[model samples]
Target: MKRILIIATDGFEQSELEQPKKLLEEAGAETVVASLETGTIKGWEDGDWGSDVQVETTVDKVSADDFDGLLLPGGQINPDVLRLNDTVIDLIKSFDKQDKPIAAICHAPWLLIEAGLVDGKVVTAWPSVRTDLKNAGGDVIDRKVAVDGNLITSRNPDDIPAFTEALIDAVKIPAENVVEHI
Candidate 1:
């Protein structure tokens, strides 16, 4: 099974993380949630704290090689805090270096910009993140989802369905190719 790594922490947008995770599972991909620490991470929803997701592993304990794809869920607080983590930035860079699929939503694109992988790529993120994406040389759009090479980005919570589909498709395409070669 394809394994997708979801790297998040306290204050993740509830739907953006959970919905895609559920959708991915339904599509036959296994997901692992990793954070800076163990235990559960609280989520933000409709302007307040919402549900909590269990962290299956810590970021320091895994690498891009551990999963077929990387998912960066967005929330106002989640990316803001994660962007400051050098280890998180480095892990993202590792995925980019290998051209592994990396899906980010809303403010989560901030981590992509920090990883220096946004330049010259077409992407879409929450309104607040558009400027950072542009400043980093990305071609930002207002669309629900943008797939540029190995990177996938979506605008907001409402775009979760499209975002999830894009990610599932990304993994499926590669898996299909592998099966054909075998």
Candidate 2:
């Protein structure tokens, strides 16, 4: 079975995290939510504080080697706060270094930029983030889903379906053959 590590924290976009996670589970992939804290993290939905999701583990307690892919759910506050965290950045870098599928949507790409994984990579993110992606040396596009190497990115919650599909496909492929499949 494929194991996917989902990284999120307070203010994560509710649908962005919940929808894809539900879809991934229905697709037969096991997912674990890791956060900066051990309790529940609140989500943001429709301009207000949304539901809470239980945190399965803390980010520092997990390793990239143990998961087939990484899923980063984005909300302006979630990625903004997480990008400032060194441990979170290092974990993202480890996933990239190991050539594992690192799927990030919406503002989540901000974390990718922090991890220094955007250089020369084709990616997409919420409109407000395109400039940052470009500045980080990423080939920013307006597509719903952009797959470069083992990196999978999407523009926003509206793109979650395609985004999740890409991640699942990438997870099912062997590391060495990921690029070819994309």
Candidate 3:
């Protein structure tokens, strides 16, 4: 089975992480949650701490080759905390260097900027990060989903369905083709 990695930290937007994880699993991808620390990470919903999602691996223990795709869930605090971790930033850069499909939602794209992967890429993220994206040389958009090369991004939790679909499409072979391989 193809494997996907989700990089998140405490305060990730609840829906942005849960919804896509469900969709990706139903699409036949094995997903692993990687974070700065092990155990669980708390999410943010509305203006407060939300549910907790289990983290299976730490950034220092994961390798880009182990995953066919990467997902970055966004919340102001989530990506902010992640972007400051040097190992986390290196992992992002490693994935980009391998040209693997990567999806970032909401403020998750901030991690991309910190990893120096935003240059010349067309991306969409939370409205608050528009200027930061632009300042980092990204062609910012306000779309529901945006795909540039191997990078995928969505505006907010409302766009999770589309974002998940785009992510599956980017890394998965057509169903007919997959059956043939099987």
Q: Over the full model, what C-alpha lDDT does candidate 2 score relative to the true structure?
A: 0.93
- For candidate 3, the per-residue lDDT at 96 reads 92
Tens-digit per-residue lDDT, 1-182, candidate 2: 79999999999999999988887887778899999999999999999999999999999999999999999999999999999999999999999989999999999999999999999999999999999999999999899899999999999988888898899889984444332212
Error of 2 at 178 (Å): 18
Where does model 3 exceed 4 Å of error?
173-182
Instruction: Please give the TM-score that candidate 1 achieves against the real structure.
Output: 0.94
Better of 1 and 3 by lDDT: 1
The worst-scoring run of ten residues by lDDT in candidate 2 lies at 173-182
Which 10 successive residues of model 1 have the least lDDT summed? 173-182
lDDT of each: 0.91, 0.93, 0.89
Candidate 1 vs 2: which has more lDDT: 2
RMSD of each: 4.2, 4.0, 3.5
Model 1, range 35-89, lDDT digits (tens) per residue? 9999999999999999999999999999998788999999999999999999999
In candidate 1, stretches whose alpha carbon ends up further than 4 angstroms from where it belongs are 173-182
